[model samples]
Target: MDAHPDPSAPAKPSPDPLAVIRSRGYLRILLLAGLIGVPVSIAAYGFLALVDWLQEYLFTELPGVLGFADVPLWWPFPLLALSGLLVGLCIQRLPGTSGHPPSEGFKAGGFPQPRELPGVVLAALATLALGAVLGPEAPLIALGGGLGALAIRLIKKDSPPSAVAVVASAGSFAAVSTLLGSPLLGAFLLMEASGLAGAMLGVGLLPGLLASGIGSLVFVGLDSWTGLGTFSLALPDLPSFSTPTAAMFLWALGIGFACPLLAWGIRALARIVRPYVHAHRLLVTPVLGLAIAGLAVLFAQVTGENTGEVLFSGQSALPSLINDGASWPLGAVGLLILCKALAYGLSLSAFRGGPVFPAMFVGAALGIAASHLPGMALVPAVGVGIGAMCVSMLRLPLTSVLLATVLLSSDAYAVMPLVIVAVVVAHVITGRLPEPPGRRLSGALPSASPSTV
Candidate 1:
């Protein structure tokens, strides 16, 4: 009979060469990742452009219009005070508390909601454009994550929560791809921050890589079109580094031990100031701004150098500092370090931005000064100091090593061993150090409803 089928017999499924891909839904998610990356990258470009324009107008053009060809030392005080008030208003009124505290470093926080994006953008614009001593990384990360979530919800209304998280991660990767100057570095930073491991790591990383690759392309294109130059970290002309001598290794150990203590002191000071900042945010934030401005003024008066050296996130200034290391007197470097560190600490307590760049600047300064001492060369000392300080502050050994070495370009290969040693030593010591008492870890806020996204 033609229709004789056994009820108990299992039906055979059709074979397909791409069944693995279809079963895992890899193609769909990857396609979605590519789609997610384009908008996120554009958003990142736009945000950076806005900040650049604002910074120039507020800090440069505004001052020139006020009859000063260059920003006077006293300019930052009033400007930052006003910025503090504006940022304070945002934090007081806006959602997501303007993202997160700078004191927490980088955390594995989930994506912020679309509603929270404005607050973040406003606060960061106020802080950075007005000369706060913090980096753009934290706000960029928040914006990227928020945009990612918002895009997915709009495109696929019924996307699973898991899928949303993956896309969000990819968006963050794409957002930071150009900023870090390497998509690989951005991927590593996100991967390490996410704490993913084993087979799960590969699965999670694939989408991020795809997004980052696309984002990097967008960054290059936009950078070309705008001719603004990619605001990426680069040390295009680093002095040659020699093989590590015993004295240089000794210097590395010393810096490794000392950098964590410096980081701890900064953290401890932030803990001391946190309660005051929270209790009187409007008052304290402005005061903190004034304090940073005051340091910049003091540095200028004492050293006869540009006060701008002591202000802002220290990203653009890093290359200059390294290139002109020989020009600075040892004592001036020390004073700059003290002033910048104090400003960095105050900013951490009251401002809203990332901590990575300032810490790197401080470490690099220390290294440059230490190199002035007999027995150490400048380049190797810089690499070691950056690795140690970054590891101590960020607690990300691999990323720190990459940051220190990668910026050195081919010299990175030669100095890699020293960077590794410093990173390991700093990482271990930082781990052993006791956590600051009475400080609450910055945790991720609850995700907003789909409507909010």
Candidate 2:
């Protein structure tokens, strides 16, 4: 046969990957996704549990046991310093460099290599448990994806790469679905972040959706069985927000304008500090941690609020912040915003964890502060702030809007219009803003593009 023989022959069209949906192998893939969801969800639950317990013991209970009537102002300094040392060591010594850098912004895909799981686990534990201003969702996603990919390799040594990617995404979906308080929210997040859309979006996300649905049951079952609740995000008992006013729309536009500037500052600070972190992981990391601790201490001293409010990811504190916003002095709320933003930026530079909750927290703080202004209600202001800030940072408008509205389910519909406006505005502004100089972490994948995966 001549090498050029095919040039003269009629060209055959390539097989459609979507056609797999009609094949029996697709059933196997779905079954595998469901099966993998079980283990991944269990592991995710356990990881969250450990992190929660450690956070309580270290930040809350340990202070009482140490004979301090209240947590001392200096508590986080040493703890965060230790966290930096451990995280630095993990990055320098471990195989995977401890997962992706948060400074790169939120990434949707890129399953971690199995060998890197330990570094991801240990670094995230140190970052989260010891009061770094980041969330656990990123680690959960990476760990789940890695585990799912590993499982497929063992189950079918000859599995195609496409099937492995689908299953890996399924595992990620199962891992964070309930944590966001809904499988659909997780689906939206990954879908938007992964840039899935059109018919291809359905094809790519089907397996993940099934995995997350099954995984939600696991989360609920475990919560009921063990009396340890699913660590889901939610906001309850807000004052009623029934209608959107002209003033509310105005505030949404203003917030949409403001959030991008704040988001830009945070990322700029992280990028400026990141080069130093890379140059001296051991020394600079802990110094940055100490600086974060100093900011928390300053906020506590000024506001008479607990240092914990500024120390960790803002998940546990977010509800209380909003519910009690009216009771807070405007000056205190402003101080909190300043302190948390600084601490969050510092964490992003050198720590290893997700950026979602801290950004949400900052947004909520801004909203609560803004509500003190004329014509701004607590619920709608909070929704607008959350949507704007989230989109500004995450650059996923759909996920940001859902997060803002869904968490406030009682007022979801009422706030949807404003949230949509804020999300779109922030998304556009963030896109037009210049990005910081790029600095990829050692052994980390390149940052994700906005284009389709």
Candidate 3:
């Protein structure tokens, strides 16, 4: 922190806020965020780890009274019903934890109050533990933001709006930096997702990104030393890609055509499910969850094989989905695609989680389906489908492209070109495609719904 030129200080009237941050008190904000965010992030890690421990302990024990017994699908029904009831009661009772997911996007302006942290953590933990179709990013972000805001309250009594926002943003960035494997990925995600385009983007975003990058490194180093599974978005052997043939280009066109229809369908189901959840929140939510669980069970029992296709988060499933899985029948793969999409949609409607993983899964399934049709290589098809569908759903081409390229190994080199083509095609197609008849308009996760991550 060297003395920076203050554009306004020359006038003897004001100090440039940006320069003030860069110089002045010497980016005490970063120091403040670190002091608070380190503990908050570690706490976030601990909270998730605790949830894992409990699930292993409680969701697996022998069936018995008050033991939270390992209930069959049917049993989770009543138990989940009770859990939903409790959750609903808690939500209604505690609006703090039930506020909203960070996937709703950061405001880039306001800061969360100190009181909001606990509810954010608990709600996310409980919702995730109950096998929601979402990820932990929301809770982690919310906790980080809250902690940073709390620190700002203590350190700089007169911290301006911009200062407070940076702290919160930095905290969030730090919290999930390593979760996604790269700080650049997180930075790009926040930059695009926050809609922080303009002169101000770099001023506010760079510091936050630096914090997240450091935090990600810290998480990686700690996890390596501690041997605790740090949930990271990486696969060592993602498929290799061939050049984009004319057939692959046609596939992109096809995905572009179908992306909106699929996106609309998912949105429609979530909206339909939302009302029922609202009506009998306590009962319907768990019942629907149990129904989803039952579908998972039936898929397993009927298929005589466990694909875990409809299980919790889909982030870790990408590598396996791309690997030696070409053996699945086209019909079966297609059906799984449809079932998982519906499950994901319904899960999105009621459950508290992010839609990114489920959307990615749907894209992968669509790709697998397309590749299985005939001569198309499985790897390229998957990449194209991922880009096309993800862009359509999230309405962001860059993020989808990163997802497509970064999720691969050697293939990303080849995959990058095709992914861009697919994303452009899908973005156009989705925009042109009419909303379903009598269908509601669906925005992206945070923009449209409160629940989605």
- Which candidate ranks first by TM-score, i.e. highest? 2
lDDT of 2 by residue, 1-453 (tens): 765666778878655657968889988998899999999999999999999999999988999998999788899999999999999998888876687788888887758877788988999999999999999988988888888898999999899988989999999999997888789998889888877766567777888999899889999999999998889988889889899999989999999999999999999889888888888889999998899999999988888889988989999889999988668899999999999999998899999999999999999999999898799998999999999999998988889999999999889999999999989988888889987655655344323212101
TM-score winner between candidates 2 and 3? 2
What's the true lDDT of residue 144 in model 2?
86
lDDT of each: 0.82, 0.88, 0.65
TM-score of model number 1: 0.92
Best-to-worst ranking by TM-score: 2, 1, 3
lDDT of 1 by residue, 1-453 (tens): 759989789998644535534555667787888888988888888888887788778877888887987777698899889878888888788876786777766664367777888988889889888888888888887888788888889988999887888888888888888787688877887777768776456666788899999999998898889997777778778888757788877878888898999888888877778777788888988888888899999998999987778888888889899889658998899999889888888888877888888888988998898888678888888888888988888888998998888888878888888888888999999999999754563433223332221
Query: What digit string (tens of lDDT, one per residue) describes model 3 on residues 1-453?
Result: 758777666555444557755774436666765666566567666766765664444444534545644455444344434445555655555544354532222222233456555555566666666555666665666667777767776876788877777887887787777666677776676667667775556667766776776677677666887787776777676555657677777767777678768987877677666656655667776776776666666665655434356655567666677674577777666766776777777666666556666777788888888886555777777877888877877777798888777777678887677778878988888888765333232342123213212
Candidate 3, TM-score vs. the true structure?
0.84
In model 3, residue pairs whose N, Cα or C atoms come closer than 3 Å (at least 3 residues apart or on different chains), thus clashing, are: 97-119, 104-446, 354-453
TM-score of each: 0.92, 0.94, 0.84
Error of 3 at 112 (Å): 4.0
Kindly report the root-mean-square deviation of model 1 from the true structure over all alpha carbons.
6.8
